[model samples]
Target: MEDEKNRTGPLMIALQYNDLFDLDSISASTNTEDALPKGRAVAFVKAVQTVNERLVEQNKSESLLFEVILIAKECSEEIKMKIVESVKYYGLEIGKFFFFKKEELINTLQSNKVKLFLSTDRDDVCEALHTGIPAALLYEQSDDHVLSQLKVIFSGDVIGFSEDSLDSLSDFGFSETQIETLKAAKICMKEFAVLIGQMKRRFGQENSPLCICVLTAWGSTNVCVSALKTLREWGLDVDEAFCLAGAPCSPILAVIKPHIIWDGGLHNMRDLSAHS
Candidate 1:
């Protein structure tokens, strides 16, 4: 009943939980009307726990720099209540909730100072990214794989950078078409890089539940090397860097068992839910 718009404190991670589940499927899967944890919410719950535990152990709990917020588009009261109940059932303690029209999403996120916006809807994620906030389209977790750590993979396209001041990536053996692809991806990755850097500083890279990686089809290309170098200069280096050199990364992704994979194409977020 209280106004949640004015709620402010530590920066937050906003989750658009509406698209995270197939409501019809969930209803069919369960016999009761009570909201049940299904889909990626299960994996997300564990991931959040892992992060919280790491923060507590490192004695960084007090600062509480990042909190979780839940956002959903306006729906019937019945559906809204179901969402609230389901979130609580999953043990994802939300600091605030926003039920707004789709058009208000960016304003809501920016007003709340959300550092990252995550959603199963690709359009929603892309919309958020255009607002200059780091956003990722998450696939549904197909299996109930209990995650001990929140493994993350960033497509090399998103992490790589070719400064205009320097020559284009094409000068470094990349084709003119490939260079065009890089240009399109530049802005989103720049903002995302900063967000990841903050996480590394807060959580401490070694022995942490947050595993960051870069997996690209670029293989061992010169531009790929430059990408890592640029990330290092930004004071952030991925824990693992894989250059598949045009190989289908599905196999590699299955082995890594990442909870979230950020692709430059954005919409191409694979269904990695099958593997842990």
Candidate 2:
């Protein structure tokens, strides 16, 4: 993956396993481990089911390739469904995940500080692009300039405007309603992932109870509203709540239902990851 050593630039830590296929073997031995919803797991694993056949042509013996394929597929399923699901239940969209052709993505993290994969399309890359310092790569390339790949870059910081900068809003073709929604989210949220880093540095790696408060947007989605209600019931000790979305609405954030929603929320989380 991109150069993870330098903290200044966009660094992606792409974890590729060595010669051990032990995890893969462990997967086939059990069926009770489930952490993600079935749909996500199926979609994730089915992605490369088409390519497994090609493994036969890798010039490796059939027995070796078959074992590798089995292990790979089993590990893939365990991660998307079981691992991600478990973390989601814990109120953290946080975990280690698999990525095909992870080396290419790591290459971007080197000097670019931003991972822009110019080559090697991996099925799992889509998961990688959606998070971690606004990373992305080409899906289908084209000659169009305005609609180029660089568009994926986090240029929102470049405008030096409020979250609702009309010009930036215009770039995405978001309607007036969409712009308002994002603003409400920002107001209620006091910190982002970047802020979380600061806190960790300030406090060090220690665990302590936190006092949280949420401000609701005027037109908050029902899910958001329901979530707040749920938080209160769960003894979150919410200090304050406000309306920023415009009207009384809440979001269905429970879909990513986590046991302990982070103080910063999962709005800018990376993707389906897991622990060892």
**Best of the candidates, TM-score:** 1
Q: What is the number of backbone collisions in each predicted candidate, taken in the order shown?
A: 1, 44
Query: Candidate 1 at residue 263, lDDT?
Result: 67
TM-score for model 1? 0.76
Worst ten-residue run, lDDT, model 2? Answer: 148-157
Span of ten consecutive residues with least summed lDDT in model 1: 267-276
For each candidate in the order shown, give its overall lDDT on alpha carbons. 0.63, 0.28
TM-score of each: 0.76, 0.20
Candidate 2 RMSD to the real structure: 21.1
Candidate 2 lDDT tens digits, 56-117: 34323322110111111224544545544543553332223443443544333333332222
Task: Give one digit per residue, the lDDT tens place, for model 1 in 77-161.
Answer: 8777877787777676677878899789899988987766777777776566555666775646654677777777776644554
